[model samples]
Target: MASETDLGHALPASLSRPVLLSAVGRVMKSARAAAFTAEEQNSPLALRAYDLRHAAVSTWLAAGTPPPLVAKWAGHSVQVLLTVYAHAVDGQEDAARMRIERALADDDEAA
Candidate 1:
């Protein structure tokens, strides 16, 4: 394992892939053994570190983080981010409708 310092320079952000998989596999195996139900034991919870990254990105999109910011954080170009994760963005229909309605109302008042 890598060592860390208070300055954060000595730390590696993550375990090497092989070491991470070994450690997570051991934990998952123990958790499966202790699961109360067969379905619970069989569920694919935290199966890989990549799954957590996907969840985090999806969550950020759902929480209304700007696409550009999310793209930067995820190390993706904005176009690629939208192409891959657009489905995670929610309620565009209602929001768009509200904006259009406000625009029309403003035009009516201006006229």
Candidate 2:
């Protein structure tokens, strides 16, 4: 819910991108420190604010959003989206297969 210019909270327009990014990074760091063990806090799995976008794209893909739509949402070309998100999409192969199997069964019953 936190936005670069969230309602009810205002960032001074004079602030630069680096400053804003650093502030968000510090907030993410503190949140991780509170929620994670020391080892996990130190790990690469520690989430940065930028990681939020990645998580959203991955979640949308996993939730069965089509690639072209996800690409548009992320402001990426379909090729770029697939190239970058191929790993996240790869995890859905089994789910896709199961869906196909169920559809085939439904078709058989309808016939």
Candidate 3:
């Protein structure tokens, strides 16, 4: 992620809160409509809404948010949340292992 300083350097001087807010509102409205349509159609035959919620919870968990906070955002009880999404949390372990292996690989010059 870019730091605040990086953002300050990248953005134009005339950038305004109202312009950003309007853009964000449009994007959010489009995203919500898309989600609702997908959910209504059950497009993937497995309920996109459920998948979307699972993804949100998984991302929050991977980002180190506490389980209680994830539960609150997901509107699930902590027990149910943990039980249902335990496998999703395992993905983070896999990702960490991959990152470690990549970091430990021999340098091209050394090899």
lDDT of each: 0.76, 0.81, 0.66
lDDT, candidate 3, equals: 0.66
Q: Against the correct fold, how does model 2 do in TM-score?
A: 0.64
TM-score of 3: 0.39
- Best first by TM-score, ranked: 2, 1, 3
- Pick the lDDT winner: 2
Residues 58-97 of candidate 1 have per-residue lDDT tens digits of 8888777789989988889999999989898866677667
Model 2, span 59-110: residue lDDT tens? 8887888998888888899999989888778778888999999999999999
Every model's TM-score: 0.55, 0.64, 0.39
Q: TM-score of model 1 relative to the true fold?
A: 0.55
Q: Which stretches of candidate 2 lie over 4 Å from their true place?
A: 1-19, 91-94, 97-111
> How much RMSD separates candidate 2 from the native structure?
6.0
lDDT value, candidate 2, whole model: 0.81
Clashes in model 1: which pairs? none
lDDT of 3 by residue, 1-111 (tens): 322332245444455323555665566556666656656444453233456667778878877677888888788899998898786566577777777677778454368
